[model samples]
Target: METLIKKNQAEKQLGLGILIVVIGSVFLLRNSGIDIPRWILSWHTIMLGAGLWIGYRRNFQGGGWLALTIIGAIFTLKHIVVFDFELSRITTALVLIALGLYVILKPKKVTTFKNYGQANQSDFKDLNS
Candidate 1:
């Protein structure tokens, strides 16, 4: 268990280090007048990067990163594709659907009350005494 925890910590640190380096490199290149694509510097790309970083930090077990990634992807796609219908409405619907699915499918945590009855009985006995 101790070794596993150390390994996970190391992995998380490595991920953060790599992310920082990549972000720094991008900024450096931009400042040097290297013409990077506009899309790569867009808000959607930032959202995607944030999602990936969060996912890496959490070992991808949590859904928060998934939500950010999906939202970013949807917006990015909207920019890339010329759809006839309203994409905002579709995005809202998709968000609702995903939320519903997550609520229904998420794992339930089981909580156990240990020695509750015995504790209550002891308390009653003490009160009477």
Candidate 2:
């Protein structure tokens, strides 16, 4: 009971953090005098997405966002880094291919439904009973 409560509380707090980030982002973006178009704005989209995902997870619902985060991080890094264009393109292609396969052909949920601090199962249990 206590464990469940703590888990729920932690999730709730994480959700609140995400919400704060989203709200803060909106305010900051509005205040910043930039030429970036609102329609293609990356920060707002990411902020809103993170907030929604975290809110859903607070209720024990899962989303395939962790995988998306990995893909997004790789793409963002590729965009920001000043590597050779050909090398960057190749790396980006490989990353997209791998991530696309994981998204489409995954055997099961990659992450176990538990706290990151908890121990992970090292062996699979066959349950045919």
Candidate 3:
């Protein structure tokens, strides 16, 4: 348990450090008259960063971060590349697929009910017999 906690802490710290470096680099480049793309500084990019940070912090166990990351990437791509079809439709389809995959592939929890004050599995088995 201690090792797991330490690992999570380390991941969080590393994520924070990377975020700081990226933000600083963006600012430095902008200040140096490097024509940075508008999309790179937009809210979509922020969403992407936030999603990545959340995923890293949580060790990519859940779907919230994945959803955010997908949305951000799709929107960012929209800005960079032109698409003939509707972006909303594509986004919705992709999000649904991701959610379905997560639901189907995520680990299932094993629940064991202990008999402290109530009847146990053995009681049910005897009743059946």
Candidate 4:
């Protein structure tokens, strides 16, 4: 889980750097008639991506990434996207709720864990015995 956090941080930093470059390029080269800048989703996309990445990285067994993603969506992607309260918000809310319920109720698919710590096989056997 600690390694997962580090990976998330690395990905977030990389995403942020890419975002900065994208914004800079868009602004600096605006007069050149290139239209690719319209796709950047700012903080919403960045944070949302981070949440999703972290969640998947840590296997989403039990954590707060969904909450983070929702908050990110509200803060970052809210104004950026066209808000259709009836269609988009309600549907998304229901979907998220369902996903959360499923995550909570369903059994974990795999229970095995790979320990990469310094403890040797003898130490593990001793502990188990």
Total clashing pairs for each candidate: 0, 0, 0, 0
Clashing pairs in 4: none
Give the number of the best model, judged by lDDT.
3
Over 8-87, each residue of candidate 4 has an lDDT whose tens digit, in order, gives 89987997798688668767776687654342546666677677767776776455787766666665533444544434
Reference-based lDDT, residue 96, model 4: 76
Query: Across residues 20-106, which tens digit of lDDT does each residue of candidate 3 receive?
Result: 898899889999999887888899989987898788667787878987888797887666634456455466676678778878887
Rank candidates, TM-score, best first: 3, 1, 4, 2
Instruction: Encode model 1's per-residue lDDT on 5-52: one tens digit a residue.
Output: 999899878878987898789889989999765666689978977887
RMSD of each: 5.7, 11.8, 5.9, 9.1
- Model 2 superposed RMSD (Cα): 11.8
Over all chains combined, what TM-score does candidate 1 have? 0.51
Taken over the whole model, the C-alpha lDDT of each candidate is 0.75, 0.59, 0.78, 0.65
Instruction: Give the Å shift of residue 66 in candidate 3.
Output: 2.6
For residues 7-96, write the lDDT of model 2, one tens digit per residue. Answer: 989977987797688667866877796544353346535643654475346442344555555554554444443444533456667667
Q: What residue runs in model 4 are displaced by over 4 Å at the alpha carbon?
A: 1-32, 36-41, 80-129
Candidate 1, 15: how far from true, in Å?
Answer: 0.7
For model 3, what is the C-alpha lDDT against the true structure?
0.78
Instruction: Locate the minimum summed-lDDT window of 10 residues in model 2.
Output: 78-87
How far residue 32's Cα lies from its native spot in candidate 4, in Å, is 5.6
